[model samples]
Every structure is written in structure tokens, then in C-alpha cells.
Target: PYPQHHQQRQEIFFGNGLTANYQARLRYMIARYAHYDHILAWEVFNEIDLTQAADEQLVSWTEAALDFLAEHDPYQRLRTVSWLRERWPEMLALPNLTLLQVHRYIPHLEHVGPSDSDVIAAMLSDVIHLRHAQRPFIFMEVGHHGHDDSDVPGNHLDRSGVALLQKSWAGFLLGGAGTGMSWWWDSWLEDNDLWRLYAPMQRAFSLIQWDDPGLRPMPVDLGSDMRILGWQSSRQALIWPHSRWSSWHNQLLQPGNNPHLGKRFAVTLQSMSPGRRYSQLAIHMRSGAVVAAHTLHADGHGRLQLKLPPYDGSIVLIITPQP
Candidate 1:
């Protein structure tokens, strides 16, 4: 009754009975489907570590699969595979497997709620712990369980789509290759009409020089229980001040606590050049519109305080050199 049974995995990857047939099938599928522009990448396998195959066979198969893709996939969509977060360090060395991915879930091995800290920390730790990959990393699959497909059966309680957005923002801001890839698109996402949520990420990212090599995570003090995270280059910074004040319990669960909604925030940005004039632009994430524009010069310790506009969910602050 199990979907991805251990014997089936072994057969698919190495048991030799179906290995050649599987490769031929993959080639046929690629030739027919690889030309679609929307198809991002070919994932070699999903959570292959969960299979019964030995480590050596998994690595060998990954290498061979990647080679197979390179030979056949002329369109050359990117390549990735998922592990259950650091289960196979050996797989990271496959140079042709250009992306690293982890499937993160709450209560996997720890007791945690779906609080801001819980969801954010779960993915954030992936970015931090998988730092050695030296390749683009992403949370390839995330939800409340080992399997998140709603078509089957079970309760994955993100009724309001708050967790999805939070994880997306957190994944991107924390140096991931893309937003946290949630697993419930057919159910929660389409059901709630939450496709509009992408506007925030798209607009904010449009204004950021995110590819700059000099960008590194910077410390910030927002003077409250805010999730203050920023990455800075010598001349600019992108800061996200996320409120843990009322989002999870209120917006996601109860859906009535709006007191912390639309509250303005004051922030102290650290790790800047002292006395340098900078122009600040605030991205009101709801509308993806720029608000709270101002200019400020950093103090002696390379800190600058700026009052960001009132926003219910969160706001993005971009600091750049004054012209």
C-alpha cells in the first residue's frame, strides 16, 4: 500500500531488472517534455535518501542520471534533487547536480508549532546548515508531514496561506536560490486565491541587486519582537522586518487579531559606513508598492535609524547610496 516502497526504490535505481527500462522511460519523457519553458528543472529523485539503496549506489545513480540528462536534455533545464535535509553529504559533491535541496517539515524530529519562529527557523536552518554545498540551495518541499499532497488524505493546517508566504520570504531573504517551494498548490493555494501573494516577492525582488557577491547577512535592531534580517553590500542593503506579534495565532489560526496589523515600525540598521548618506525605500508588501521614502546618514558606529511606514504583515526596506 505504500507509494514509494523500499523494494520499488531499489528496483528503480539499482536492482537491474528495471534500471535500463527506467532510463529509457526517462529519455522518452525528457524528449517529449523538456522543451516546455515553464519546466524549471529535472529532479533526479525525490528524497532518495529515504530509499533502501546503499549510499554508493545512490551516488553512482545520481552521477549517471545527471550524465544522462546532459546527453539528452539539449534544452538544458537546471538540475536538482532532494534529500531530507543533510542525510547524504556525499551527494553534494555531484558537480553536475547543480542545485541542493532539502524537504523541511515541522515536528520531523522536533516538537514545534507553526509559529513564525517555527516555520522560519525550520527553513532558515537549511540555508545555514547546507552552507557547504556551494551550489544554489532551496527548500524543495515543505509542509506539515512527510507527504503533503492533499488529494490523498490528511490535515495540513495552513488554511490562510500565511505560512506559505512567510516561508517564501524567509527562504529568499536568507540566501536561498528561490522561494520556499510549498507542496499544497492544488488545495490551499488555488482554493484561497492566494496566487496574488506572489506580487510582494516579485515586486520587492525587482528592486534588489540580489546577485551582488558582496551581499552578506547583516544584523539589525527593530526594537521589538520582529524578525529583523538584512543582507548588505558595502553600498546598499535589503532589510525585512517581519512581525511575530500577531501573524501565526491571529491571521492564520483565529483570523481576527488585527491590533498589530498596520502598525508602523522604527529600525536601526547596522553594518554600514559611518556618516554615509543613504536613500531609503520601503516596499509595502501588501500592494508591493514603495512607501516611506527618506534619507539618512549613518552614525559613528555605522548604524542608521529609519522609521518605516505602517504595514500589517511586513515591509521591505532598501538602502542605497545617496546620489
Candidate 2:
């Protein structure tokens, strides 16, 4: 219990007895559940930016709250918080708070909303660009547009669940800690039994060496109706190409609206060791099958050109330096 929840929680942040009660509850929760190993970091708040508490007050309260957690908890687990606006640098810059979280749901087009990958990329880019210190960012809450009261379907209302799946993949593939914990898990995904949609991420995520700190997001120049987004370290590179023509809007609302995209695509993978040979495997995202595998040697300019086999939804490409 921190001073960073909705407007109603503001009273607990200020009220004398209320604040003590909140602390007691927090301590009780820790004493009871901290023994478990599976629990992730202690999230200080869901979306503090939505709260009525002032930033200065929230910052002071958060520091004390974090100290309290460290003092009481025997495990001394990781601590973090979430923000919709990313406005509190003082809170984010706290060294003890190692993880930065944001809940993203921005819209695009008239009523089509932003594409799935676009949302992740935008949130990630915001966290990367806004933070005072380098910290791991996670999309703690994400969905098309928060499943609001609008009678009209906002951006991603696809029955196929592809929209949310794309966002999840982009979060991991674009260098996040894991897939975005989409907001509509029970109502949208679970209600429709969309758990199987994430099957492709397991194998594709395994291909990444996440411990490598040098892995950076690399730009992909594509000559097709797709955009390749991923990262590359010295030893390996992983990227996903999602068709620009087939997006949340068209695929969900207007399926097959775009003209037939070519089965083959051409692209140059940049920022690898020049004149080096690498093993490249193009895996189908939906089925997690290796559709194409080849030995690709980069030119002296550090560019490896390749052709992607025909795919419907999306594809994950894995490239590793050959010995």
C-alpha cells in the first residue's frame, strides 16, 4: 500500500490512522506472502499518475514506503511502480526502484487505433527516452484502449486476439523484460480462450540471450510491406517482421482488405560484424515452425540480405554468428 493508487487512495496517503493502517496491511501481506519465491517485485502502485496525490508528496511517501519494505521484508525483493504519464522523474530516478513500468493505451487513425507493435514501440521508446537512469521497463498494463465505456470498438477488438498477441511479441522482441501483461486478460483473452495465441513467443524468446547488456535495438530497412523490429548483440540477433499492410485494423475489422502481399521480401540486417557469416532461421510466428534456414554472410558493410518465406500473420528471424 503506497500513496500512488486512484483518487480515493489519496486519503490513505494523508490520513493519520489511514496511513498506519495501509502500512499494517502492507506488512501483513509481506509477512504472509513474502515466503513464496514466485512473487515478482513489490509493485508500489498500479498507476500513480491517475491518483490525486501531489508529486512531491507522493515522492516523499514512496521513499519512506520503500524503506519500510526493505526494513521489514526478509527477502528484500525488487521494488517498482507504474505511471500512465511518466511524469515523476524523482520517483523513477530512485536507485532502489530498479524497474520502470508504464500502462500504455494510445489511439491512432480515426477509429482504428494504433497497431499492436506500434503501441509497444511507443511505450518502450518513451521509457527509454524519458527515464533519468537506465532501468528495465515493462508494459505492466496494456490493451487496445483499456476496454472503456465507448459503445464503439476503439482500436483492437479483433475476435482472433492477434492484436494483443502482436503487442506482447513486440514487447519481448523489442527488448522488454517480457510480454506486456495485457489489460483485458479475463474479459478479452481468457473469455475467448486466447491463451494458445502466445505459443510462438516461447521458442522465439528462447533464442534471445537476454543477459547480454550490449544487445541494442537495431533499425531494419525493409523493401516490403513489413517492418522488422528487434535487437542485436555481438553474438546474436533476433527480429520480427509484421506486415504493415495487415494490421490490427484490417486484420480484425477488415480482413484481407490489403492487396495480396508478395510471399518473398528483401531486407538488409545492419549493425553486425562486417564480412562475417551467420546462420539465419526464419520461423513462422503463429506456428513456431522453422520455415526457412540458410547460412547468411554479411557484406563488409555489416548488412545481411535475405528473403522471408511466405507468411500470413508474422515471422520471427533468428541470426547467430557462425564459427
Candidate 3:
């Protein structure tokens, strides 16, 4: 409901007796702003399913709008629209939509759980689903609910900030085009002083050369409960692991009783060059610090198994081969 000057409060939805006017407004927006080089993408609408329209109508409306944007936008910025989890299949089918976008929250609407493991497991499942998208995928909204939840204790900061941070890193390493974008940016993040969490993520991602064409998703086997996600090029690999049981909210809510912290485990790397000895294997904290390094050898079948150090939460493993 932005552009309050012209937008009717109740007319945001498509097929709401104002389709013509909405189309005209969209035309005006493209003509006005499509020339801006910094504009990343054009989102047709946010959470269109919330309109409660029939699925057929929504899909038709989405296709038409996507067609208009595709034909008119001079720069052809990435086209995307957000959808509830149930409507994801329809959204993915839109021919002109260049980027896949999904909206998810902790204690999901259908499957609610405040448990740290439950939340991570759910989020990871969603990420796995998005892997089928031909184009890049992104989690458009991720965070704890802005409203008070009777199931969890403490304010949003104590309850959701750490979970937000954890999910962001998880989404990024799990092949998301970008980290999960937190909703309620002003009130939930900045006001609560949780904005500082982005610093470490920024540093960690900066080490990656995203433009390298060889970088592609790679398989990682950390066994059950523990998950490993990674991408590899011929020269290097980036691996990230997460424990299903650890969460910041749990740590804060119960200081002495945190069972998920400080655990050691072996992670196996697959699809490596068989019988090749990698020059360096470095483990990095999410804050972008190198905690450990090793020279490792892959087995005959192109797998390498390494025992990781004991630590709370998640860590990134970077493997590099001699040139």
C-alpha cells in the first residue's frame, strides 16, 4: 500500500475492480524508475496470496503483470513476487519471474514450533524445496513474529534475534541467492539493536568471489541432525554446518541448561577429486575468523572426512587446492 498519495487502501489486490488502474500505475512506475541502475529487481507484489483470491485468478493476474513488466521495463530488472508456502508451486511456474522468492517465519503458520531444532529443521526443509528453482532463490521475509507470542519468553530481541541470525547464515550457505531478509526492519531489528548481526555475515560472504562461474552447489554429509551445505569450484569450496539442537534464544532463555553447545563431530566431503590431497582446509567462525586449519586427503572415491572442533552453533569450512 505504498504511494499513499494515489493508492487506495483497499485496492492493492488484483481483480479487485481496479485492475485497469493498477496496471496504469505499474506502467507509470516503470516509466519513472526503470532507468535507475541501482534498482535491483521489480517485485510485482508482496504476499499476493493474502488477498484471499482464488488461486486461478491470482495466477492469471501474476502472469499478466509479469508479462507487462517483462515487455516494458527498459533494463529488464529481475522479476519476482512473494508467495505463501502453499502457493509456491504456482509462483515458480510463472515464465517471466526471474528470481524465486519465498516468505517464511519462525513457528511457521501451519507447523508451529518454538523449539530451536524444529525451527531450523523447518527452515532447512524450505531451502531444500527452493533448490529446484531454475533461477536464483531468496527468502524474502524471515524473522520471529513481531507480535507477542505466548509460547516463547522474553522480548523479540531475546526471543528471535539469534534465531534470525542463525537462519540468515543457514539460508546463505544452503544456496540461497542472499541471506534471509529480516522483516520489521525498523522495529524488530534496528530498534532492538539486533542490526549488528549483519556485520559478520558481510565479512564472511566478502571472502567469496561470487562472480566465478565455476562455483556451484556441492554435496556435504554431516549425518542426521547436523546439516552441511556447500558450494565448490575447481579451486576452492565453501562448506557450512548447523546443529539442529542449538539456538541463541534457547541459550539466552536457559543459560546453564544449553545441551546443544560445545559438541564435536566428523563431517564428510563428497564429490572431491579422488585421491587428491588438498593444500588447505580452514574452519571459520561465522564472524569470519579462522579457528583451525589442516591439510587433508580425499579418499579413493573422492571423499574427505574431517573431525571438527567443539563449538556452539554453526561454522564454515573452506577447502582450497594447490594451483
Candidate 4:
């Protein structure tokens, strides 16, 4: 007999009902991966919302998956799912669900046409419903890509995107959404092509991580002397205080700061794994202007507090490996 049937995505088991083959597979996975502690959540599928084939069926499958996890582990595992913002509501109703993950991208201005504030509003509304009612939601993925035209405000878009997302995070703290994730193109920004592009974002989200999740934002006024900027996504966070960089007299064009413009500055370090490598700091300058920048680092760690002042900065703190 079939345990359930949801053929929304190709990942759904072929042939029989949801119970028979799919449930069996689910059990197999849990058993195979004994270290459940490391697993964040059982991501059912990516882009499954776009599949119109078996919407109801998929829901049944999700419910079954949740049941399977609950049966095996008493410590409620987050029944998480990710999809375009349009598909968030369908999964929010599931029992014992942790977060409703929504992926959003701005395809207008830079490229394509039209902005869907309506969609954004609807998504926010759903998040509001979930959070106020004690349910949780997050922007699973939020970022943008370059435009074909010259007027692409890629970094601005990313900065503003997370800023917009923080509005929901504020709501969550006030008992609204749970968490959020800011998406980025690894290659685009890593090469420093998008310095201003994602640096603010990396700094923004880093605050959440640095705060270590317990403390909420406190009210403080630095006036024009300090500027706060950041970037965040579900999996990662980054924050930077622009005042630190801008305070430098003249541009700090030390080596590694800008390889292309000469006097490029580069620092080396290692991380135990990708997860620990949270953020990075580097410097980029243009003639009379100098700025210290920070972004997420996948690997690069192990050292004392960076003494290099005109220090480009490490996105994540470098901790010495224990002997």
C-alpha cells in the first residue's frame, strides 16, 4: 500500500504511494546518518513549489516526512522547506514545523521588468501570521544577480534587500518571523568585484552571528561618526562598522588590498571546516580613498587578534587551534 503520494517534484519516489517507497527511503536516510545533531533540518526539496503536478500529494509527503522524523527523534527536528516566496503559505500549516523558508530575488530595474511589491507584501504578511501566532518563518534565500545593463546596483540591491529582511527580523524579535538568510554569489564578490556590493551585507549579518543569537539589538546613537551596514541569509550572517574603515587617513593601499590596482594585500589562514569560516575582512582603495572591507570566509583562521591595523580585517575571528 502507498503511505502517501506527492509527485510535485521529480525527487518524489517513482511508482507506488507515498508511504510504501518514500517512507522507507526516509527511514533509511535517518538510520544511515546517525549523527542527527549536526543536521540542521531535513530539507525536503528545492524549488518544489514550482511543480504544479501534485501539490496536494507533495503536502502529504511533507507531513509524512515530519511524522517519520518525530517518530525517530523526540527532540523536534525543524521540518524546513525552501522555495520561491510565492509557495511559502502551503507549507506553514504543517504541525511542529520550525520555519517557513522563502527565497526572493529582484529581477527588475537591473534586468527583466516590474517589481512585485505585492508578492513581497503577501510573503511578509504570511510571515507575520506565522510569527505573531507563535509559528516561525525565515527568508531561506534572498539576493540578486548582475544586470545585463550598466546601471546594475547589485550591491545596493543586496544591502537594501537584507535591510528590508531585517524589518521582518525585528518583527520576529517582537514575536514575528524566526530567522532569515541573505544569499550571495560566491564568485562575484569573492574576487572583490563586488566589494561595496556585499561587504555591507556581510557586516550586517555578522552582527547576528557575533551577538551569538541571544542578545537582541539595543538602541544606540553614534550620530554621523558611525554607519552600520550588514548582509544576512538563513545559513550565514555578516556585519561591518563603516566608521572603522573610513577613519583611516588617506587610502591604505597596502599589498593584498587591491591586487589589480597594485599594492594588493592578502592574509592567509585556515578553518577546521566551512561552517567555522564565517566572515572575512579586506581593504580596497581608490586613489585618495581607503576603506577596510569584510565578507564571509569559507576557510581562513587560526591566529591572535589581527594586529595589522591598517588591518584589512578577518570576516570571522581567527582562533588558534587547541593543542
lDDT of candidates 1 onward, in order: 0.70, 0.69, 0.68, 0.42
User: Which residues of candidate 1, in runs, are more than 4 Å off?
Assistant: 1-12, 16-18, 33-37, 107-117, 144-158, 217-225, 243-266, 309-313
The superposed Cα distance between candidate 3 and the true structure at residue 227, in angstroms, equals: 1.8
Q: What are the runs in model 4 whose C-alpha is more than 4 Å off?
A: 1-21, 34-36, 85-90, 108-126, 145-179, 193-323
Model 2 spans > 4 angstroms off: 1-12, 15-18, 106-121, 130-132, 146-156, 219-226, 257-260, 311-313
| Pairs with steric clashes in candidate 3 | none
lDDT value, residue 254 of candidate 2? 76
Whole-model lDDT, model 4: 0.42
Worst 10 residues of 4 by lDDT: 246-255
Candidate with best lDDT: 1
What is the C-alpha lDDT profile of model 2 across 107-161, one tens digit per residue?
5334544444345346556556533356677767766664353432543356667
> Looking at model 1, which ten-residue stretch has the lowest summed lDDT?
146-155
> Model 4 over residues 124-162: C-alpha lDDT tens digits?
443545544355556666444344333445444433233
Give per-model TM-scores: 0.79, 0.82, 0.81, 0.46
Q: Tell me which of candidates 1 and 3 scores higher on lDDT.
A: 1
Global lDDT for candidate 1? 0.70
lDDT of 3 by residue, 105-145 (tens): 76533343464335555666676666777789887787765
Query: Which candidate's TM-score is highest?
Result: 2
Candidate 1 lDDT by residue in tens digits, 1-323: 22377777575556443367668887897989998999878887888777767778778888888878877898877888777644566787777888788776544223445543345554565667566567777777765453445332212455556666776777777777787787767776787676787887887776767777778765433345777766778678887887655444455446665655667767787767888999988886556778678999999888988777775666788888886
What TM-score number comes out for model 2? 0.82
